[model samples]
Each structure stands twice: as C-alpha cells, then as structure tokens.
Target: MNPWALSGVVLVAAVTFYLGKRSSRYANTTHDFLVARRTVRSRRNAAAISGEYLSAASFLGVAGVVLKEGADALWYPIGFTAGYLALMLFVAAPLRRSGAYTLPDFMEARLASEPLRKLCTVAVVAIGVLYMLPQLQGAGLALEAVMPAPAWLGAVGVTVLVTVNVMAGGMRAITVVQAFQYWLKLFALAAPTFVLCVVFFGTGGAGSAGSLGDPAPPVFREDTTVTVETGASFEVSEETPVWLPAEEGGQRVWLPGVRYEVDEGTTLRFPEGAPVPAVSGGEMDNASWLRPAEDAGALLGTYSLIFATFLGTMGLPHVLVRFYTNPDGKAARRTTVQVLVLLGLFYMFPVLIGALSRMYVPELLVTGRTDAAVLLVPSAMLPGVPGQILGAVTAAGAFAAFLSTSSGLLVSVAGVVATDVLAGKVRDFRIATVTMAALPAALAVSLPVEDLSLSVGLSFALAASTFCPLLVLGIWWRRLTWPGAMVGMCVGGGLVLLALVLNVLSEYSGGWAPWFIEQPALLTVTAAFLATIVVSLGTARRIPDDVNAVMLRLHAPDPLGFMRDRAEARFGRIEDRSRKRGKHRK
Candidate 1:
C-alpha cells in the first residue's frame, strides 16, 4: 500500500466529515436543510457548484478521451463549459426568480399543476440516479490508484461518506464541502501538471513529447507492463514481441508477435517503442484520432454529444438546486459567471494530462483501461518519492471529485424523495438520503465499469431529452400547458430509456443500431421540444389564468417586491402599502 495515497484519502475524508458536522448545527429547519435558507454568497456558491459539476468524468474521463481520441476529444470539455453558458443565458436568473426548491417545485410553480409537479419530481430522481452511478464507479478507479482493492470498496466508501455528510446537513453542509473539494481537485491536478511539464519539456527530462500529427498509432515511449483485468479482444497494428508472465508461479516466456487476445489476469510487458494495440471495438491511427469526425456515425455522435451537454445543463437537478441556495436572481447569475471561470480553469489540467498521456502512458490503450491514465501518469513520468507523492495527490483529488459530485446528487435526489415521494418532513429527508444512495451503490459494485465520460454523456443525453425542453419552454413560453409538459418529458425521457435498453440488447446480440438511434439525443431532444410545442398549441385554452402575473414575477426587476410565490400559501407575505410604510424605518 502507498502510505501517501492512503493519507491523502484520509485527510480529505476527515476534512469532509468535519465540515459537514460543523455545518449541520445550523440546518434545523427544512428550508435550511434544503436550500441553506438561500443565504450562500455568490462566490462560495459558485465554488460549490463547480465542485459538484466537475465529477469523475472531468477528473479522469476527459483525459481518457483525449488520450484515446486526441483532438476530437477536445469537444468534451468545450461542450461541458459551454453548457453553463446556456444555463446562465437562458435559465439562471429566471430559474432563481421562480422561487422553487426543486425542479418539481419549479414545474408546479410555473404550470400550477400538481400532476405535472409529480412527473417532474420523478424525472429529477431518474436523472440524479443516472448521474450518481459514474461518481461511484470513479471512486473505484481512484482507489485502485492508491492500492489494489475490490471495486465495491470505493462505491461503499463513497456511499457511506456521502450519506453521513448529506444526512447531517444536506445542501447547507455539502456546499462547503463541495467548494473545498473544487480547490482540492484543482491543486491535485495542477501540481502534477506542472511537474510533468517540467519533466517532459525541460532539459534533463523525458524530452519533447511525440508530435500529435504522427499518422501511426501511439507507441510505448519506454518499456511498459500492462495487466488485463478481464478477457478482451484488441488488435495490434503490427507483429511485435512481448513478455508474458506465467500463471501459477511458472517461468516467464517471450511471446513472438501478434498478441491479439488476452484472458483475465494476463500480464504483458512490451519493449520501448512497440506499437500499443488498440481496443478491438474501435481502433484509429493518430491521424484519424487527431481529426474531428471519422465517418457519418462518429460525426453524428459528436453533434449529439455537443447538443446533449449544452442544453442538458438546465435539466441537471443537482446543478439547478444549487441556484436556490443563492439569495436572488442576480446572485445566481453572478454565481454562474464565477462557475464558468472556475470550470474553464479546472478543465485545462485535464486536457494537459490527456495530451501528455498519449506519449507517457499508452499501455492503457492496449489494456482498455484508458480512464486510469491520469492516475498512472504521475508515477510513470516522475520516479521515486516525488512521483509517489503526486500520485497520492491525484488519487485524493479523484476521490474528492467523486465525493463532491456524489454529495450534491444525493442531496438533490433526497430532496425529491422527501418532498414528493414521502411526507416532506425533516425525518423523511434523512431517510431519503440513505434510500437514494443505496441502489446506486449496489449497482456500482455489481455492474461492469464502462467508459466514464460515455456513461456521463448518456446521462446528459437523457436529461437533455427530457427536462431541457421542460425547463427552456417552461421558463420562456407562456402557453406551456400541464399536459404538454407531462407528455413532452415522458416522451423524451421514455425515448432515451428505450434507446438505453436497445443499446444493451444490441451490445449482447452483436447487432448495434445506427449512431442516431444509439445516441438518440439529436433526435430525442427535437422530439421532446416538438411534442411539448404541439401539445401545448393544441391545448391553447388550458394556459394558466395567472400566466401574466407569474411571468411578471419571473421577468421583473428585484426591487419591485413582487411576491415570491403569490399563488402558493406556504410562505407568508407583506401586504398593504400604507401599513408597510407606517411600520417601515427610514
């Protein structure tokens, strides 16, 4: 076991628990627990939002994609950062002005329909669950960098940590934890990046990284050993010799050329400058990898990916819930601005690691575990104690990414379950935290780990297909009817889920559908928007009577003293201008 790596994990956990317990003291009421009484400041809330937004996919998967796909993978981070731009421009101020605690609350408030609110609550939970799975899987990958352990350990550990922290203080507590984690993740990534740059670019180091324009596949920069965790098929570009470790403590043997297949637990050592075999399912030379689109199918997937991430931000329940923690519409917008800057800064390090990994850690390509590139690179580049220390730091940051995002997701999930599924009580929220995390933890431990970014992108596609339209239309369009919202979300969410099922079936049956059908966002998002519009236009007479008043509340400046929730009786209000003037101090 690497003590430094283990220590970093312990340190982060200690800090998280300490902050959570400290914050829990003030979160006595439901409002405080759910939205931090809307007292979080712009900068602090932005940090927390950034923390939660940069999940395992950003920490490891972005670099993994870059290492594998090269220039084309640049779109992942671009799409991710661009998403918040959409959120800020279209949804941020307006959503905050709506005075809703959850996405369901927003729906019900906007449409004045209880049935539609219930549907939204269900969608929030579904998206939260979908997003949570990657965080848990990322936890497993992070732990492996520290020490070899069962996949279940990381999932269970993160679940318990998230549950304890969330159950203690909810959003109020997690805001602080997530904010701290954002910086921690930044430092974790930035430090290694600096050292690697010096080692790779500076004199007396590894020398210049290989040119990106090379047409050949990435080769081992130095002799490397790669262990295949499961039986898998991948193709080697050329005949190459390799050293294979024998089973049952037998002697090692030099295998000549064309090692095309590997079984579980197979360990193969390659000589320096040997071609790194590409994964069997998809293989590309450096020239193709560097380019944006390969063919019709890949080009379609790229468009779908960008579309899903950009529009999908509004649909993410965890992200939108954070805006409620801001005091007003302006604060939410300011928070978004800060979030954009912080996200832009954090994303740079991932691209650096990914680009460098192409030269430094190509064994991952052969192993089909490209996600481990960031975790493995520090030690691979810098030998001895320095590498170990950096490795530990990277591992800690990875864990923090998992915990930070998972905490936010758990809070959002618990909010829906407690408010919509249960009695909407403090006790119910506490119960819901555990209940929401339990299923995902179990699934994370049992299920096979997929591509982290791909899994997360699918969650984005699902959200984009469903709630993106619900949100964009609900906020902008006055004619949106309850039936329209319901039909649109259901149709959109249903199609994505159907595509997922089809994807599974096709994967097992070896009969995958075309790119649009498998990816689905490009088509599904359009379908949802059309469905909502068509249904609402057909049911034009069903618009809420107070649509004008609600629109005034949403669009009006903050000083007007328009009601927070004029139609809802849950919150009290100030009334009578003469009486208020008489009671008012200068």
Candidate 2:
C-alpha cells in the first residue's frame, strides 16, 4: 500500500463525511430530505448533478473501453452528454414543474393512480441497484490496483461512507458534497492529463507503433512482469519466454499459434519490444478498434448503444431526482444546460487518457482489465515519487466517482423505499439507506468482475425501456391513463428484463444470441415507446379528470401561479393522509 495515496483517499472520505454531517442541519423536514425544499440554485445543482452522473463508467470504464475499443467507444461519452440535451428539451422543466419528490411521486401526481406509482417504484429500485453495482465493482478494481487490501474493501468502504453521509443529510447534504466532488474529480483527472501531455510531447510525442486490429500485436515499451489473477487460455502472437510459478514447474519458451494455459498467480515476464498476447474474450486489434461498426452486427450494436444512452438519461432514478432539487421549471432547464457544458469538458480528458494508456500500459490489455488504464498509465509513464502521487490523485478521483454516484443512487432508492414501502419519515429514510447501500455492496463483492461500462449501459437500456416512455408521454401527452401507463411499464420493463436475463444466459450458449443480448436497446427502447403510445391511445377515455390542470402546471413557467398553488395543495393533502396513516399504524 502506498501510504500517501491511501492517505489522500482517506482524507477525501473524511472531508466528504464532515460536509454531509454539517449539511444535516437543513434536512429537518421530509421535503428538505427529499428535494431540499426545491431551493437549490441552478449552478450548484448542475455541479451536483454532474458529480453524480459521472459514475465509475465515466471515471474509469470510459477510458478503459476507449483504450480497448478505440473510436467506437467514443460513442459512450457522446451519448452520455447528448442524453442531457434530450432531457433539457423534453423532460427537465416539466419534471420539476410537476413538484414531485420522486419518479413514483411524479407518476402518481400526473396520473392520479397509486398502483402505477408503486410499479414505477419497483422499476426505480431495479434500475438503481443495477446502476450501483458497477460503481462498487469499479471502486474495488481501483483500490486493488493501488493497495494491498482485498478488492472488496474499496466497495465496502465507499458503501459505508456513502450510507453515513446520506443517512445524516439526504439530498440537501448530498448537494453540497457532490458539488464539491465535481471540481475535485475535474482537478484530479485534468491535472494529471495536462502533465502527462507535457511529458508525452517533451518525450517527442512517440505513440504506440502497434496496430490494434491487424496481425501486428501491441509491443511493450519496457520489460514488464504481469501476474495472472485468473487462469485463462491466451493466444500467443510470437515466440516469448514466460516465467511461471516455480511450484508449477519453471520458466518455459512459448511459441506462436499455440494456446497457453496461464494458471492463477502465474507471473509472466516479457522483454521490451516483445509482442503482447491477446486474451480470449473480445480482444480487438487497432484496425477493428479504430473502425466504427466493421460488420452488420457491429452496426446494430452501435446503433442500439446510441439509442439507449440518448434516451436513457431522462429516466435514470438518480439523475431525475436532481431536477426536483432545482427551484423551478426554468432553473431545471438552466441546470441541465450547465450540466451539458460541465460534462462536455470533463469527458474530453478520458479519451486522451485511454489513448495514452495503449502506449504506456499494454499489459492491461493482456489481463483483459482495460478499465484500469486510467489508474495505471500515470505511474507507468512517469515512475518514482511523481508517478506515485499522480496515481494517488487518480485513485482519489475514482473514489469520488464511486462516492458521488453511489450517494445519489442511495438517495433515490432510499427515498422510494421510505416513501412507498415504509412510512415516509427520517428514521425510515435512514433504514432504507443502509438496506440500499449494503445489498449492492455485498453483490458487487461476491459477483465476478464484468465490464463496468457494459453493465452501466444495460441499466440505461432498462431505464430507457421503462420510465423513458412513462415520463415522455405523461408530461406531453394528456391522453395517457393509469391503466395504459401501468401496462406499458409492465410490458416494456418486463421485456427488457427478460432480454437482460436471456443475454446473461446467452453468454454461455454463444452465437447470434450474444449479439442481440449485447445491444437490446434498439428493440427494447422502440418496443417501450410503441407500447406506451398504443396503450395510451386505446385508453384515452380513461384519462384522469384533472388532466388539463396537471398539464397546465407541468408546462406553465410561473411557479407562483394558480396551477402551482393547486399542486402544492394536493401534495399537502397527500402528506396529511400519509401522516394520519402513520399515526394509525403506530
């Protein structure tokens, strides 16, 4: 363990906890706990939103994917930022104007149905959990790279810190902490990237000579030692001498065109300028990696990814909740605009980091853990004290990624659990926070590591299939009914869930199934939009009686108007009823 790096990470966590505890003073009411009484400024809320939105996928996984997949992977960040534009034009203002605390609250307020609200709550929890697992897993991967502790420690530590902060202050506290985190993350990544760029140019801007897609394999810049954590078969591109564990015999000469069984804990040494072997799964060369959609299947997958990410941002539980924190409809719109700017700036660095890693840390490609590219590259290129410090900064940024995103997810999930499942009280919120944080942390630790960005994209696809349709039609189309919304959510969410399960199963079965599973968004997202539209038109007669009033409130700009007052009155009535029910249960 590099004590300096570990100490930096520890200090970040400590300061985060203190910030949250300090903000707890403002979270005295249920309203403040959930949406900070809708008092947040546009700029601060924008930072907080960006902080939470740039999850492990953006912090680590994007660079890793770009490192492995090249230009095609650029779509990840493009789609991510573009999704916010869609949100700005369509969902942001209306969602905030609806004056709802959660997605479920929005559904119930819009359609006047408790059942659909409950159904939406289920979708929220599912998406939240699916989204959170990758964050925990990413944290673990990052910590394991820099420290001697078990991989699970990073996930557990983040979960605990996030839970404590969220339980103490909720959205109000999280807003302050997450806003600070956005700047912290930007500094951490940007500073190193600037220095690395200088170093690269100072060293004559020499890049990797290896082609990513051809017969030519990646060449190491220096003699390196690679320890295999799991046993796997690798294709040797050249005759290389590899060192194995003494217990498993000794060093042996490896030949080209032969598959080698690299046992767990086996250490291999490759001389400088030697060709790096490719791993078994989805290893692409520079030509294929740089090319966008080299085949019909690749084209479909690319389009599906674009479709999911472009539409998915509007429906994310954590992302949507941030809009509710804004002061009004216009503020929400402004916050989203700021978010696009901030995100656009932040995403530029990751791609550069990814490209740099291909030259500096090709060993990661052999291990099939390209996600560590951002964390590994600084030390590989710089070395010594400077490298250690830079590596620690990157690690701290990675932790901030986990902490910010997990905190947002926990708040959204815990809010739902407290409001819909338990009594909507502070104590209930605290309990739900623990449950939400712990369950995902446990799963992240136990499950085998998978592609972090891919898992996060799947969650986005699920959201696009489920809530995207609900929010789009609910806000813009007045004909939507409770039954239509419910059925659409069931069919859309259910089909995507089924597709996800089949995709997981197909990993074993292999063939065309994997292609469809890998990119179900094209089908699932389309099916969801169609299902909602068709069911809504068919149930036009069942539209709520107060549809005009709700629509007016959602669209109108004046926050102090009659429609706004009416909506607030309704919320007050609902709260009174909820409090009475709680008293009765007590």
Candidate 3:
C-alpha cells in the first residue's frame, strides 16, 4: 500500500484525462465521433493503431511468460506483431474503401439489406462486449498489484474515465490519447530495463557471480519431527528440515534436536549453504520415442497460437473500426504497413525485458505473479533511488497500456451498440454506451483475478468467431447475399458464444461434458466462413447488380470522393445529382 506509488499512477491517469478532454472537442458530428472525419494521417494513425493493439496483456503478460516458459513464450509477441502483416496484405484497403462507419454499416452497404445489417449489428455488439471485459479486468488487476487499492475500485474508476474520454471527445480525442500513450509506454519500459542492467553490472557481480550464492536450492521434507544437527550452519522452515555438515558453509548456525511443526504443501529454499561436490560425467545415451512426440507437441501448440493470432487479427472489431476511420483506401493501406513497422519496434523491448526477468527475477514464479515479473525486475536489479524511479516509470507504462486499450475497446463496443441498436438516438446511444461500458466494469469486479494473457485470449476467441468471417467475406466476395450473411453470422456468432459458455461451465463443473475444447478460433472461424459461402450459393440468383459496383469501390483505389460518387452512381440519376447540387447552392 505505497502511497507514493499509487499517487504516481493516478497523476499519470489525470494527465491522460486532460489530454483526452482537450482532443475530443474536434468531434462534433457522427462522422467525427465514429471515424475522426476520415482525416488522420497514416503515420500518427499507425502509432495509434500500434498503441491500441498492444494491450496490457501484451506488455505485461508476454514478459511473464518468457520468464517462466523459456523461449517458447516469445511466440506470443511474434504472433501478435505478425498479425498486422496479414492485415496489410489482405484486409486493409478493401475494408477502408467499403465506405462504412462500422462493420454493420459495411454489411448494409455490401448486401443492401436491412435484415443483414441488424444481424451484423447483433454480432458486433456481442463481440465488442466480450472483448471489453478483459480490458476492464486487466485495469483492475494492474491497479491492485501496483497500489494498495481494491481491484473493483480500480475497475470502476477506469470504466468511468474511459467512458468519459470516448463520450465527450470521440475518435479524435482517443487518437491523440493513444498516440501519446504509445511513446509513454515504450519509454517507461525501456528506461527501467537499461538502468537495471547498468546497476546490476556496476555492483561487481559480473562473470564469476556464482560465489554470491548457490542458486536457491530445492527444499524437501521427510517427516514432521525431522531435527537438524547442523555441525556448521542450516536454515529450516515449516515446510522442510535440512542439516548442514561442518564443511557446508564455514560456521555452525543451527542447534540440534529442536522439534518443530512442519507445514505441508508450503515451499522453502536453501541459499549458498551446501557446498558443491565436483564429478566427471560421460554422455548419457538414454533416448526415447516419447521425446520426439513431446518436442512435436510443443511445436504444434506454438503454431496453433501463432495461427490464431495471425488470422484472428483480421477479425478484431476494434482494429477493423479503426480502418473505417481512414479518409481513403490508400491511406488505410499505408496505415496498416506503418502499423507493422511501429509494432515491430515495440515488440523488441518487451522480449528483452521478458528474457531479463527469466534470469534475474526467478522468484516471481513462486508467487505466480509472473505478469508483474517485468514491472518488479528493475527494483530487484537496482535496490535504491534509481530502482524506485524505474519502478514508477514502468508502472506508468503499464497504466498507459491499460488506459489506451480500454478506451479503444470501450469506443468500439459503445459505438456499435449506439449506432446499431439505438441508431444515434441521443438518449438511447447514451444509455447503451453507459451500460455497455459499465457492465464489463461490474463483471470485472467479480472475477477472481487471473492471468491477463488468458483473459485476452478469450477476447480474441470472441472476436474471431463473430466478426472475422463477416468482414472477410463481405469485403472479398460479392456473391454473399443477405440471408447468407445473416446465417453465417448466426452460426459463427452462436458457436463462439456457446463455446465461451461451455468453457465457463466446464471451469466450474470440471468434467468432459463439452468435450473440453480449448482453442475455438479454428473451428468457429471455419464454420462461419463455410456458412456464409453455402447460404450465399443457395441464394445466388437474388444477388443485386449493385454488388459489383460497390465491390469495385472497396477493392480499387480512388480519391476520397470514391464512396460518395459510387453511392451517387448506384442510386442517383442525372436529375437527382442536379437537384442535390441546387440544394447545396441554396
């Protein structure tokens, strides 16, 4: 419960709030709120995109994984950064050219059906809500860990802060906030890591540092009353009893026959008390077929995670909504590539910190707070003022990560709920936005804190299931009909929701009732895609001729007026344009 630490976090948040308020005044209309009037340049927008994409999970969780799991954990960040690669190649230009404020808008224009729009809207809101929960939960967990505050309080506070930022200022405000937060987050981590390394090396523990201690030794307990007669020295805990021989350490530090109660299931470790016994050994030639399977199995797991991330990036609603905010298709494409570069740069630092945590702060594994492993590493490496300053900076970075990401998810969910369900009815949009943001905050309060990465993965599963197919097929395929889109959305959306529910139930009930499916992305995404294609084929004759025209606009490069012109060409005659022009003059 450090007041200074908590105050630092709150001060940083206050500054972010001020920046958001100042930036939001630019949003005056629905277009401004939804897409920043489609005027954001590619470079700044690219940084903003990277800022939103790298959530608290990526910042904090990845390092923890690397610390615990060795090189295998590096795959998470690789998959995350590589996701933008897939987007740049396939989804960027067409999605921006679709001339829609949101995915549901794209659906209405693409299929020319109010029914399909409604279905897509349903899926959008559902997935948005699911995705928001983890952001809220991450915020709570971060605040709880760094400060003495209760987790629920942090969750509620962040919900209010982000909701205000979005509702008051809209996309313009969020853009500025995210862009600024990205740099803040980067330096926050980078500064501490460098300082920690310098301090560690300067402490004269360079090469032959083994003399400092034998890596904390494993503790083993034989029975309850095992007494230690340390001829030299020893340390015993409730969990284990060990005796040190006269030659172990250099002095006798333990008394004999001191009976004590041993607490089972607890952990204890010995320091540099036991002397090493040198031995020469030959290569052990024991090999088994199981070894190959174990290695292959690990590789399969890594590939599965990477695959889910790459394809799943294309389907994320928040990410897709950002594309809709671009002024033109080319700008969107440029933004995508820039985002790749920005993310690639950001990924390098986290991997370095993760590796450092593995070597230096191995104790974090005992407490299962590997998520905070990076944040605490600097303090462990540098013990005084420099360490404290580095810790504060890292905390600020983590706070920035949570705030920027939560704001993005809040805007995405609230925008969808407002536009689709309420249709910009002021009162209803306000209510929907408030409720959408508030529900997750409340739910986050109830969660018994879990690893941030696991929760983020669930959010990805929801996004992949509901919106991935809708965006992919709607953009690339013209034959996709309204009924087909609706059916596909329902099947895909339904499977994802069902999978999530089954997962929760299985977690609570603990059995093989649902067949124990872990990764839902592959199956759910395929089902959605298949459903769209099948239904569209069955209803192919009902396809509208305007589909070809709209598809061209989405796929081809044109000026910013491309959408307005295509809209006019599809629905307006010469007389209609003249009438519109006349009205504009008046």
Candidate 4:
C-alpha cells in the first residue's frame, strides 16, 4: 500500500464531507433539499451534472474496456457524450419547465394520476440502485489496488460517506460537492495522462508503433509476476514455464496447443518477451481489437450499444434530477451544452490510458480485471516516488468518481422513496436516504463484480426501455393518457426486466442467448416506444382535461407575462385569504 495515495484519497473524502456540511445551511426547506429551490446557475449545475453522470463507467470502465476490446470500446465514451446532445435537443428545456422535482413528480403532474406516479417512483429506485452497483464495485476495485483491504470495505466506506453527504444537505449540498468533483476528476485524469504521455514519447513512443488490433498476441515487455484472483482457463500460444501451487507441483513447462487451468491465488512468473496467454473469453490481436465489426453479429452488437447509450442519458434518474436544479428552461439547455463540453474534454484521457496499458500492463489481460488499468497503469509505467504520486492522483480521482455519482444516485432514489414510500418531509428524506444507500451497498458487496461497463450498460438499457418512451411521448405527444403512460412504463420496464433476468440465467445456459441478452436495448427500446405510442393513440379520448394548459407550461418559456401574472395572482390570493382569516380570528 502506498501511504501517499491513501492520504490523498482520505483528504478528498474529508473535503467533500466539509463541503456538504457547509451547503447544509441552504437545505432547510423541503424544496431546497429536493431541488435547491431551483436556483442553481447553468455552469455550476453543468459541472455537477457531468460529475454525477460520469460514474464508474467513465472513470475506470471505459479505459478497461478500451484496453481489452480496443477501438470497439471507444464507443462507450462517444455514446456517453452524445447522449447529452440528445438530451439538450429533446428533453432538457421541457423537463426543467415541467416544474417537477423528480420523475414521479413529472408523471403525476403531467398525467394527473397517482397510480402512474407510484409506478415511476418504483422504476426510478430500481434504475438508481442498478446504476449504483458498478460505482460501488469500481470503488472496491480501486481501493483494493492501492491498499490492503477487502473489496467490500471500499463499497461500505463510500456508501457511508455518500449517505452522510446526502442526508446533510440533500440536493443543495450534492450540487456543490459534485461540481467540485468534476474538476478534481478532470485534473486527476489529465495530469497523469500528460505525464504518462511525456514518459511514452520520451522513450521513443514505441508503445504506439503497432496497431492494437494486430493479429499477433501481446507479450510481456519485462519479467513479471501475476496472481490469479479467480480461477480461469487460458490457452498457451507457445511452450512456456510456469510456477504452480504446491499441491500441483513446484513448476511445470506449459506447451503450445494446450489449455491450462490456473486456480485462484495461483501465481505465475513469466520471463521477459514471453507471449501473454489468452483467457477463455477468446484472444484478440491488435488488428481485431482495433477494427470495427467484421461480421454481421458484431455489427448488430455495436449498433445496439450505440442505440442504448445514445438514447439512455435522458432517462437516468440522477441525471434527469439535475435539470430540476436549473433556474429555468433556458438555463437547463445551457447546462446541457456545458455538460457536453466538459464531458468531451474529460473522456479523452481514459481512452489514452487504456491504450497505454495494453503495451505496459499485459498481465491485466490474463487476470481478466482490465478495469484496473487506469488505477494500476501509472505505477507500472513510472515506478517509484513519482509513480506513487501519480497513482495517488488517479486514486483520488477514482474515489471522487464513486463519491459524486453515488451521492447523486442516493439523492435521486431517496427523494423518490421519501415522496412515494415514506412521508415527504426532511425526516423522511433522512430515513429514505439510509434505506436507499443500504440496499445497494449490500448488493454491491454480495454480487459478483462483473464487467463494470457491461453492468452499467444494462442499467442504461433498462432506462432507455422504460423512461425514454415516457419522456419522449409525454413531452411531444398530447394524446398520451394516464393509462397509456402507466402501461408503457410497465410493459417496457417489464420486458427489460425480463431480459435482465434471462440475461443472468443465460450465463449458465450458454450459447446464442448471451448475445441478445448482452444487448437487449435494440429490441426492448423499440418495443417501449411502440407500446407507448399505440396505447397513447388508442386512448386519445382519455387524455387529461387540462392537457392544453399543461402543454403550454411545458413548452412555453418561463418569462411569458401571462404565465408570470397567473402564478403571482394565485399566490397573492392565497396570502390575502390567510391575512383575512387572521384578522377575523383576532
């Protein structure tokens, strides 16, 4: 364990806690706690939004995916950023104009149906919890890399910190803390990248010489030791010597064309320039890794991934909640634009880091823990005090990623639970915070750590399947009725949920099922949209009586004189009535 890295991460957590405490002063009211009284400026709100949106997937998983899958993985970052563009164009302004604090609030107000509201609240909590698992797992993985701690420790520790921050100041505090974290994350990634680039170029840039997809397999650049944490079977491309567990015998010479099983906790020492063995997942040469899909099935998977990510952003509960913080519709649009720029800038570093890891850290491939590339690569490349400092910087950034995203998710899920399940009050919010945080933290520890990016992508697929249709139809299609929205959410969410269950089971069944399970969004998203439209059109006569008024409120800019006058008149009448009652009583 490196003390400097540990201290740096601790310091970041402390500072985040302090910031949350300081922001608590502004969160006295329920409105403030839920939406910061809708007063956040665009730039700061954008930062907070970006910070929360860039979860474990962006901070760590992207690089790992890129390292293992090569150019194909680049789609993760591109789709992530493009999703915001889709949001800006379609959902941002109108969602903010809806004057709703959460998705359930929007559903209730828009559809004027309590049942629909309850359904949406359930979906929000489900998506939030699913989305949070990867963040927790990423935290555990990062901490384990830097310190001698069980994987669950990091998950539990982060959950506690996030809970405190959320309970302390709610949305107001989370906004301030998350905004700061965006820059911290940016600096943490950018600085190490700059240094690593210098180191790479200074050493003749040989790392960049070959295509990552070259048919030739990767080889160790130096003598190396790799300990398998999980038992895996791998193929030997050439004859090689490997150390074995005591029970298996001291050392054995592995031969070409044979598969060998490496048990958990088994350590293998490889000589310099030896070819890295390919695991059971199948090996990719630089050529295959860098190339786009060469087959129809691969092409389908790529498109499905793109479709899910591009459409999924607007549906993320945590991200959509951030729009509520903006002062107005225009501010919401501005916030999204700013988010695009910030996200684009921050995503560049992770891909580079992943590429570098392929050359410097091939052992990660053998271990099947490529997600650790960002956290492990710096120290591997630079080794010594400088490397430790860089690693510390990366570690701090990673923890910040977990903290910011987890806090935002907690706030979103807790708000839904408080309003829908518990009483909608500050005390209830606190209680809901604890419940929401605990459930996911427990799951994070209990569930096997699957591919971080893939897990998150499943969350995205769910969101895209369920909420994407509701929001799109809700905003643009006036024929949508309460029953239509409810059915759409249920059917769409239900199908995706079914797909998710089948996906888990398919892992055991094996065969062609895994491919469809891995990317359900292509079919599920279309089903959702079709169901929503058909049901909505069929139930056109059941549209709410005040549909015109609601549409005006959602589509019109907030500065319109009549809308302002109407709001003032309503509040003014309430105040006058209160004063008259007071005088009569006296």
Error of 3 at 490 (Å): 3.3
Report model 3's TM-score to 2 decimal places. 0.80
TM-score of each: 0.92, 0.91, 0.80, 0.92
CA lDDT for candidate 4 = 0.84
**How would you encode candidate 1's per-residue C-alpha lDDT over 381-472 as one tens digit per residue?**
88788988988999899999999999999999999889888876678999999999998998898888888998998899989998899889
Error of 3 at 260 (Å): 23
Task: Write candidate 4's Cα lDDT for 335-369 as tens digits.
Answer: 99999999999999999999988878878987878
Q: Model 3, range 481-524, lDDT digits (tens) per residue?
A: 88887887788667766876786676555333332245566677
Model 2's number of clashes is 5
Off by over 4 Å in 1: 203-211, 221-225, 242-269, 281-283, 563-586
Order the candidates by lDDT, highest first. 4, 2, 1, 3
Pairs in steric clash, model 2: 212-285, 212-286, 213-285, 213-286, 213-287
Worst 10 residues of 3 by lDDT: 277-286
lDDT of 3: 0.66
Tens-digit lDDT track for model 2 on 1-586?
Answer: 7666787788889889998998876466676668766778999999999999999999999999887778889999999999999999999998988878899989998999988888999899999999999999998998888888888999999999999999988987899899989999998899999999899878865655353435465687777788876556676656766666778667777777676777666788877777777665444355555667677887788999998899999989999999887767888999999999999999999999998887678888767688998888888878798988998898899999999999999999999999889888888888999998889999999998877899999999989889998899999998888888887778777877888788777655533375557788888878877877888788888899999989988998754664342234423543454354331100
Q: In model 2, which range of ten residues has the least summed lDDT?
A: 577-586
The local lDDT score (0 to 100) that residue 509 gets in candidate 1 is 59
